[model samples]
Target chain A: MARRMLNQDLIEALTDNCAPIRPLPHPAWRALVWFAVSLCYVAIVVAAMGVRPDFVAKISDPQFATELAAAFLTSVVAAAGAFSAGCPARPAWERFAAGFFLLIWMGAFAVGCWRDVDAYGVSGLLSHSDIYCLPTILAISIPAAALILSMVKRGAPIAPFVTIGLAALASTALAEAALRLSFRQDPAVSVCIWQFGSVVLLTGIASLFGRALLHWTRRDALIASFQAHRR
Target chain B: MSELSDTSNDRESRWRALMASAQDGDHAAYRELLSDLFPVLRRFVLRKWPNAHDTEDVVQEILVSIHTVRQTYDRRRPFTPWLMTIAARRVADAARSRYARGANETTVDILPETFDGDGAKSEQETRDDREALRRAMAILPAGQRQAIELIKIQGLSLDEASQVTGKSIGSLKVGIHRAIKAMRQALERNG
Candidate 1:
């Protein structure tokens, strides 16, 4: 009888020691979505450049080309880091760097789009048309959508998005101030409204969507934890 | 001597073959290995955990992890320690979970050997013995309790207990000896 009791106790103890099983977030799905978004961005750039057959030869200076390539590579690294925020093990520094680079890339792209229209003398585009602010809007909105989705899926806190949005708005305001001082041109109110409005909209959408996604996925476990505490 | 050495080598080769076959996704071989492992794993967990209700759950989780990460195991390694590593992690996780849930409030009491016979001891004597054992156990250092559990209750050889606890064999034996001696002394005083 004592032996049986000992055996029972042993069995009981072993059972108590069993570990809880936690489901790992699916890595493949995240990787696939990131790859698709990257491909789409590359496709858009290729289309924008019109894929001219003689475009490669037009860049005659190797040194200048090297600098341009280096800049592009840095931008790509930033994009990759932003995309990698979806990984479960992403560190804080990586997320911060990714966010920083993403802001720089968006600003650069917006300025480049505006300048391209002006330099090419494109009619019906932002430069010749009454809608001089359209290029910046498009540039900001497109990347904002992608960045918002990535940030939301990665479960970034509300504060980072808000800070980034405010920073973007402030940077645009600063750039406008600089332009006014240097070129003596009056800053457009429409540009300021568009920049601030886009930041607010993107930040709001990303935080809302990310919170919703986390709530939906972890609802059961969250509810269980609460219930367990009550008991 | 040569024949004995050849036979020993043959046994090792056979064990290696079994391990290789199991690693290659052979269900029969895997089942065979698991059958041999189940008792040892159960014993190891029981000594560490002592809670009946959670043992099966932990064992199932450990088995599932073993299945999932089977590819990561090296065929050349002895399977016992590999399995024990998983078992230890599972046990630690369970302990954490229990602590988080605030379910570790049960009072444990150990009784003297005199209280064992069905009709030999009076009810008062049995209760006293139980109280004495409980006091003795409470007074023991944590390492000594662990040593007693692993060596005496779990029936692990001192060397095996040392391996499980990551203590030197000599230290583990001394710990177990000291714990048992303390418990006996505590019981004698009460008697």
Candidate 2:
């Protein structure tokens, strides 16, 4: 089929009317900045909430310390993955690394839960006093998730699922760490379900809306929309 | 291996220069880059979609995709792989959409004639049908939207749509029925 030549050169419609091209920072640099931003947000949340009096005592275990370190590392790795997804042809090893650390953290959380069960029986895991865990984890994820969404919008991501997933993962993982640290909650079956479940739940939700979340500001889309309005 | 790498390096450098100039608001450089890219991108798509006659559409889609994500391109990186990755994806997506669209009308449907937009309808009737279809489609689930679009509007055979979209023929058939039912309900409520 013969193609109709576009009346106005699309190049002119683009370069002449569109905003000036901005130089993209390296994906690693962008990821580092996102990591720092999320870290500062966590710091603020901790300062505002006030660290639990027993925080030092609870975090004393080598295993617990490793869990905290793993959480922080997961955020950093996942941030890298999120940023890298925006760039075409970039390696996604950062995302893979994030997944690896996430599994490790999951195992650590399970261990912590097992310890809690050992001391406090299976029924004791669902303490009425800890209902705040659900809301806190979800609330903490918001600002970080928003920041990631804003940053990722600056470029197109080939794997929208990976980009959105990593963004949700990085933000929620860090929040979980920050909340667990400052609030001093021992992992229990119910507590773990509410805290870590929030991240898994949000990530699953993000996958559904990934395509809509990252709208490509293509000139064609703009022009077609304009023509549609005129019609 | 060394020779191939060397040549690859050289091409990357040239493309990077073109992109840099384009980034600096050089229209000439931008035009040159796009013009140079078109054939290469077309060939790239054709390689994957060898039998696809409408490679032109795929080429245009690739260009739009490139333009959409142009800011994400790192000048320091080789441009070829990035371009090829997009080309490959666009071709695959187009093929998928086409594949899934091939089956809208199936044997289970009681009234096969309603949504097909046969020529017997007057201009006003056609307009009303289109309007109702549009509103119904906007509210349809994405899967249903795809089915209605490829099969209903584009008039692609279910088998053809299925080939591109990778959806089972039965699924597309069901989607069309669901879409038509929804549209009828919407039109009735509005009426």
Candidate 2's displacement at residue A207, Å, is: 2.0
- Prediction 2 TM-score vs. true: 0.71
Candidate 1 lDDT over A3-97, as tens digits, reads 22233333233233323333223333433454455446544654553454544552453422332343333333433443333332343464455
DockQ metric for all predictions: 0.02, 0.20
**Deviating ranges (above 4 Å) for candidate 1:** A1-231, B1-20, B50-57, B69-82, B101-191
Alpha-carbon deviation at A120 in model 1, angstroms: 32
For model 1, the TM-score of its B chain against the native B chain is 0.44
* Top candidate when judged by DockQ against the true structure: 2
Model 1 reproduced share of reference interface contacts: 0.00
Off by over 4 Å in 2: A1-8, A11-19, A113-132, A188-191, A215-219, A225-231, B1-10, B105-191
True contacts kept of 2: 0.37
RMSD of each: 19.7, 9.1
CAPRI verdict (incorrect, acceptable, medium, high) for model 1: incorrect
TM-score of 1: 0.28
